[model samples]
Target: MVARERIITTVRPLDENRIRGSFINCSKGEARRLTLPRLTEIDWSEVDFLGWRDPKAAHNAYLVTPRGGEVIGVALRAAEKHRSAVKQSMCAFCGTIHAATDVTLFAARRAGAAGRLGNTVGTYACADLACGLYLRGKRRPAVHNPVDRAPLEQRIERTLDNLARFLDEVTTDNAR
Candidate 1:
C-alpha cells in the first residue's frame, strides 16, 4: 500500500476556477453534464488531490492533480452505489453492473521520487467502464448504439493518459 499526505501549503492557495476549467476542458463534451462542488466546501488544506462525479453523469467521477497551485490533469472514474443492505462497488468502464463481489476498482498511482517523497495519491475507477452510461445520456446497453462505444472509450483513455502526465509533471517539478 502507498501512503500519501494531503497537500497543505498556506502560501499557495488552490485556484478554484483554474481547477474547474481544467476538469471541464479535459471532459470535453462531457463538461456539459458535469458540476463541480464549491472549492470552499472542500478542505483544500487537507486535500492532496480532489475528485468528484460529473454533474450530468453523477456516476462518472474525475480526479484532478494539482502542482504548484495549478491543476495539470484530470482522471475519469466509474463507481456505483448500491441500494441494498450491503454496499457494493461497480465498474465504470464495463457494462457489467454487479454487486461489490463482481466489481473491481482501478486507480493510477504516482511514481518516482515525487510519489515516494511528496504527497502522492492514486486515482481509481471500475476495471470495466459500465459507468460510462451516465455520460452517454444514461443510455443502457438495451438502447445504446454501437457507434457511441468507440468514442466514449477514447475519451476515457485520454482522460487516464492526461492524469498520468500530470503525475509525471508533479514528479518532475518536485525533483527540481
Candidate 2:
C-alpha cells in the first residue's frame, strides 16, 4: 500500500501586505480596514494558521492559512451569543472538546457571486480561533476530555483536512 503523506501543520510568517492580499471574500477597502494581529510577536512554527478576532470589531474574526502552497484568508463573523458554559462542544477543526462557552459559531461569506448574493457558511470553532495551539499542546482546553486519541501528526493532518473542507465551502462558487 502507498504511504499517506504527512501534513505539516505550520504556516510561514506573514506580513501585512501578504495577509491583506490573501483575503478572497472581502473587498479591498474592507480588507484594508481589517485590523491585523501583531505579526512579529507570533511564533509561526507553532501555528498551522493565523487566526484572530478583530480588535476594532469584536464580532469579526479572520483566518489565514496556506493551502497547496498558496496563502488564503477568510473573514468570519462570530455569533453574538456564545454557548453556555454548562454544556460541552467540540471544535470542528481541531476536535478539542471545550466548555460550550469556548466554542463560537462563525459564518464566512462565500467568495465571488455567492457572497455578493448574501450566501454564507458557518462552523463551530474555538472562540479564540487558536486551534493550532490546542492541537499542538501549546494551550490546554478548559475541559480535559480528549476526542481523538490519534498520534500528533495524524491529528494535525485531520485538523488541516477539516480546514481544507471549510475553505472549499467558502471559496467555491456554487452560485454559478
Candidate with the greatest TM-score versus the true structure:
2
Q: What lDDT is reached at residue 79 by model 1?
A: 38
lDDT of all the models against the reference? 0.44, 0.87
Clashing residue pairs in all predictions, respectively, total: 13, 0
Off by over 4 Å in 1: 1-13, 24-29, 79-176
Residue-wise C-alpha lDDT for candidate 2, range 83-152, written one tens digit per residue:
4546888899988989888889999999999999999999999999998789878889898875566888
Which 10 consecutive positions of candidate 2 have the poorest summed lDDT? 1-10
